[model samples]
Target: MFESIKRDLSFIQGLLEGDVNHQHHVEYRGLSRLVDVVDLLVESVEQLERRLSELEEYVETIDEDLNELELLCYDDDEEDDEWDHEIEVTCPECGEDVTIDEDDLDDENVELLCPKCHTVLDLEEIDEEDVETVISED
Candidate 1:
């Protein structure tokens, strides 16, 4: 199972390093191959878990192996942050958070007027960690 993963890693590395600009086919093909590798690994792990119920030590070893494989896929320098954060002004009249698309705004102190309330409210910087919590109660 690990051998298959190694091969898939090589495949992904090649695509990442190669000239991705000219070839669109390589992108789709590589992604599909990586997906297949993950699916196969998951199925094998399920079987391994069932068969090794008696030995806790063996299970721990398998778990470590899987964890290491997952870490290999992580790119430390890649800007993988989807939510490129920003400062959001509040609408004084409506009390709603007024945010702008990251592309349009410059990184500096500026007065941003809220279109919702037509109120130019001051904004504090927000980070990714400052996520709004939503709880659904039954």
Candidate 2:
């Protein structure tokens, strides 16, 4: 479409230049100015089209990266299923209820902190009989 318009404009410009008798006429000058304006508009549209194509390519790359990150972050496994079980224990320092992941309980050296008060909670100090298992309905 742009090529056709450019060809037609070129033909009109050739005709205007060939007709030397009407070079100084008002209508000839008007047509000449109109052609220049249309030429500028066509060039602007071509530039905009190029920029839009570049933006589309950039967006596509970002979308692919996001898909890769989602797969890495949200992939489901049996190991992750074990983490679903939680243990509820009260913080001895502040008596605040603290929820700990079951996976963390397996590591005897893991230290817990109370959210309400910054006190170190020793898992070994809390007896297994006193700790309650929290089961999620989900």
Candidate 3:
């Protein structure tokens, strides 16, 4: 549409320039001004179209990032589920009931501390038969 308008404007300009008798006429000057204004308007519209295209591309990139972030968040939730089987034991130092994730027990280097008294709890001292695996409701 813009190309067609530009072509028509170019034709008009060619005709105006060719007519030497109407070079100093008020109507010719007025038409010349109108053409200049229309040219500027067309350039402005083209610039706006380019900017809109760039904005669309930027939005698409943001959408992809959001999808990746959502997946990472979802995977984190699933990872949390793996440690749902908690081992509850009474801390011998403070007699406080200390809860531990089941996965942490597999790591021999992991030090278990009683939260109430900050006393180091021996993982080896806790009997396997006494260690209760509590399945959380949620």
User: What's the CA error at residue 63 for candidate 2, in Å?
Assistant: 0.9
How close is every model to the real structure, measured as TM-score? 0.25, 0.65, 0.56
Regions of model 3 farther than 4 Å from truth: 78-135
The TM-score obtained by model 1 is 0.25
Kindly report which residue stretches of model 2 are placed more than 4 angstroms away from their true locations once superposed: 76-83, 88-128, 134-137
Which candidate's TM-score is highest? Answer: 2
Tens digit per residue, CA lDDT, model 2, 14-49: 999999999999999999999999999998998899
Candidate 1, clashing residue pairs? none
Candidate 1, which segments miss by more than 4 Å at Cα?
1-77, 87-89, 100-108, 124-138
Error in Å for residue 132 of model 3: 9.0
Q: Please write out the lDDT profile of model 3 over residues 1-138, one tens digit for every residue.
A: 778978988998888889999889999999988988988898899889999999999999999999999999989998887557889988877788888888887789999988999999888788875577888855
Full-model lDDT for every candidate: 0.60, 0.87, 0.87
Prediction 2 global C-alpha lDDT: 0.87
RMSD of each: 24.3, 5.7, 5.4
* Minimal lDDT window, size 10, model 2: 75-84
